[model samples]
Target: MLPLVHNELYVEFNDEKQGPFYPAEGPIPFGKFRKHKKSSVELKADRIGELAKTISLPRSALSGINGSDQALLAQANIVQMEKPKSMPFDDSPFLQSTTFKNKLDAKTAIADYLGKPLSRLTDLQIVAINMILDETLDKKTVMDKIRAYFTLSSAGHSGGD
Candidate 1:
């Protein structure tokens, strides 16, 4: 049986307000949800295609967060072409150092994105790393262009020569 769903959508145009006798969307204004708790966005299947158009803050904008937040923010698949990863709490020295609070996770993610072991990075990959370290490349762009072939082919293309 189809469950009865509420229709509380309300809208106001330039001249007047529009609403059902009982609004389906809002009796109250939407406010910042409690932090660190999972929240589900309810949408009809047909409307979900619009969800892809939504976005959060950019990677550089995420840089000012605290250590744990910075690490968590690092592993997010902000790169449109990449898949999100399930990374553990990496406590490696490379990350423990002030430079890379999330470097270990980033390294693991880059390795997985390239389908190669971290130990086998090519010279081009090294160049990409240098570029990333020097802020010449955005990590998101690097991952987005991971297998883009012609774009960074001179630097490297995924794994192997």
Candidate 2:
């Protein structure tokens, strides 16, 4: 489960009511936004998927409730009218963890493996590292793929290395 903030955006669509309605992006509506910051209010992925199935609204409308471009991206693949299968939500523990030491260790390990300064890496880089690690790729192969993916320069490194 994850806490979500529903900040309405000002946009007009023929299917929706006129004036300050929620949009996926752009300006905040009515100079205020709705927030669900409490852990109890958070919705699990499966629960969200189920709730989405019951709604007549399109996926785009649900994305608008998320109130961020990243949230929109996360929901892009979900079918608005279909129910999603139950799956473990990885983010729950990560978000609720009392200590960040494990997270920091993982990040540092990724930076070390990439042979680059951690400051230069983006959030996407961290995600890629986690993906590769979870898939249990061999060290050299994973590093090579990551280097090529990021176009990082190295000795004997070809453009697609």
Candidate 3:
């Protein structure tokens, strides 16, 4: 039996030299492929710009383009063609730092303090706790609200406790 091959094509409008992605199958039609490629590149560039802004990184770090939409689109296409590998969280020194570990421990501590099963906590609750531990929220105020929501009477009254 012939193995099923997935036809994946990637293209970039900005840097035509970087790619004509054909991961599994043969080359894609240049005309239709270019249109989709350009749109994808634009979207990726916009996303990278937004992320850079959030992290306070220089825009150039995320996008090498200036004010020109054409240039931005081109750079994005080059990036897509490069098919950069995603950095694993475990490999990031920031994520592995003592401070980060302490914060993670604090989050786990909060879950333990509430006596609520970790599985029972909603995604929002987990995010809230992490945010609080990171000082993204005022600890005193956020803890009070969390305690009230969980109906936790005291620090030691965890369900398991």
lDDT of each: 0.58, 0.61, 0.61
lDDT by residue (139-160, candidate 2, tens digit) is: 4555566667656434446544
Which regions of candidate 2 fall more than 4 Å away from where they truly are? 1-115, 152-161
* lDDT string, candidate 3, 39-91, tens digits: 88899999999998887656755785455765767777854356679975676
Better of 1 and 3 by TM-score: 1
> Worst ten-residue run, lDDT, model 2?
97-106
Which of the two candidates, 2 or 3, achieves a greater lDDT against the reference? 3
| Global CA lDDT computed for model 2 | 0.61
User: Which lDDT value does model 3 have at 52?
Assistant: 82
- What's the CA RMSD for each of the models? 26.7, 27.3, 23.9
Instruction: Write down the TM-score for model 3.
Output: 0.24
Once model 3 is optimally superposed onto the true structure by TM-score, how far is the C-alpha of residue 143 displaced, in angstroms?
4.2
Say which candidate scores most in lDDT: 3
Better of 1 and 2 by TM-score: 1
Name the best candidate (by TM-score). Answer: 1
Report the number of backbone clashes for model 3.
2
